[model samples]
Target: MVRLPTVVIIGAGNLAYHLALNIHQSQVKLLQVYNRSRRGLSKIKKNTGVETSSSLNKLNRGADIYIIAVSDDAIRETASAITHLISKDAIIAHTSGSVSIDVLNNLRAELCYGAFYPLQSFKKERDIDLRKVPIFLSSHQPKTLKQLSVVAREISDKVVIIPDEERSKLHIPAVYVNNFVNHMYTIASDYCTKENLQIDHLYPLMKETLERIFDNNKPQDMQTGPAIRGDKATIRNHKKLLKDHPDQLPLYHYLTKAITRYYDENN
Candidate 1:
């Protein structure tokens, strides 16, 4: 980070793919990219114009920073694989939200290890503005954390040094907001399809739901539903509508009951 860091991204999956593009756009020296196979490497090389390789043994040594952007489960193995290639003091890190930075340290005790997690789900086909994405960084060593902050600031204005415990806790709400919420969208889409309705009809509602968050509206305060209104007839109707669709019935009942509990307490 202090030296206008050079990067060698070690993975060709979605996170690595987008990271390469954004890092390339950041104007950092992306020295090389490596994957275990040639499958996704070609598209990355073609897109970012960075050299790509499939051999870990052939990974260029002495880069300022090596980004281990591989999958979470593969982190330990990947870090072990590159231990021999990097210098004793080389900076190496991963982009996993669930995995700890110590996983890298455990593999290569001589080198420096850190976390370079972007707190957003990445899709290769979809472009993201990294400037708006909050980047959480952590390292066992303060020096490494400082260096990571420097690199993170170069790519994103929103950077923070979050410890592993806090980072893990932070990912919980991320799941509620992103993963679980997306599943709710899936259910809504399926229900629409079952009812012979176009899912496009829900897009505006979806947009407004997100916009309300940015407008600083608390979801509880904005709540509007039969449960909140204590309209038993309307809630029973919704339950009846979904009863035939066994899979969605339970979810509908659960959410209604949960919302009702909130108002029940207030009353």
Candidate 2:
């Protein structure tokens, strides 16, 4: 029988919670989960039936891999604290898209370190099928990269070997697509609430927007609406409608101008 890698997860945020559950369900042996507080640990422990630790010193040193699935700011500090506690042969990795792997490598020169970033926004309350999510792996060492790939493949089918520089660059568009787009939805929902309109009415349009992109249609080619059509009259009317929402007016103006400028320059 082939032996699966033993794992230890640090931090119990959204990503950590999901990773723990996925790893537990996988062939990997999840030894323990550690968080500074007990807030999120209980849920992870109860679901995964894995040991939980609040202290870094109490981490399982025998685990083959230690994944620091914490916030971007806390990754370095968390890795630094567990530098001496982890096994020398253990592979240390962080689950961050923007952060470089040097954050872990600089702390533990002897142990192999890399990144196991899942390019998906996680919410602890919602369950996600990680097999569909793309996981990006990076490491300076060839052997370490291979090892990380083995673990990554167990949880996700789409595993890509993306270096730090390229991964950081990808994060920019990721934020634009996910975060910025979600903020737009929030604004639109707020507008609907103010007007006493059903936000659900816009769901079909929103769904079609995503469907076009997934169908290999170019966003620029699919661009429609008053801004792209250069309909100044409709634009003026839309601006007038936003008179009651002073804060939202600037964003609406900026986006309209941006869209207009892009199409104009291309045409």
Candidate 3:
């Protein structure tokens, strides 16, 4: 593998956009950017000043690494389609926490392959301190793992060689913290709109909640809520308030019951 491998990024979505930006920012050669559609191609080209292509056929086969930053459903399809397009020695990686390295290799039986999962949510417009984000690396071959890990370390200090078994475990907590928590935020914002309340009013609560999580023990050990406190009256009152919002009520009740049950076992 080249010291700083040349890269071809596939897809033009959030992950691709940010990955392209970071890869270039780290002074790695971002040779090409490809997307299935031209919709957001111009924006990425403008920001990175790198050549972009909407067609996979236009990709440079000589690039040292190909990072498929596409969606989970498209990982296999894109890998399979691009297998013959690149150098057989080129390392192909996907930035999916849930997808296995075997899937990438299976899709392209002979080529070197790996997973280059950056375990963080990305928004293209906002700058991320990539070093702070954990980039999980996995590969069937040690040379492939070393190459991918070298590429990963360029953008993140927290690179770890995680096997599929442990990588899948990491994805679970990632969903709990980022995806599921973000959904709760979405629900909160909608709730605020319906109740004539500003969602920003919850910022302090959110801030302190995060502070405790970071400052204290495990989330379960740091757990504090009416459910865990066994404050039945408060829980009842909260449920009554959500009664009119039937959609949110179910999750609230279910989570409350779950929290209560967890504490019940402890007590």
Q: Which model scores highest in lDDT?
A: 2
Error of 1 at 106 (Å): 2.2
For model 1, residues 170-223, the per-residue Cα lDDT tens digits are 888999999999999999888888889999988998999999988999987888
- Ranked candidates (lDDT, high to low): 2, 3, 1
Q: Against the correct fold, how does model 2 do in TM-score?
A: 0.97
Candidate with more favorable, higher lDDT: 1 or 3: 3
Error of 1 at 117 (Å): 1.0
Quote the positional error of residue 255 for candidate 3 in Å.
Answer: 1.0
Which of candidates 1 and 3 reaches a greater TM-score?
3
List runs of model 3 lying over 4 Å from the truth.
none
Report lDDT (Cα) of residue 17, candidate 3: 89
| Candidate 2 lDDT score relative to the true structure | 0.91
Residue-level lDDT tens digits of model 2 in 146-260: 8888889999999999978899889999999999999999999999999899999999999999999999999999999999988999999999999999989999999999999
How accurate locally, in lDDT, is each candidate?
0.86, 0.91, 0.87
Model 3, 99-201: lDDT tens digits are 7777776655568998998988898778888889999988888988988887788888899999977887899989999899999999999999999999998
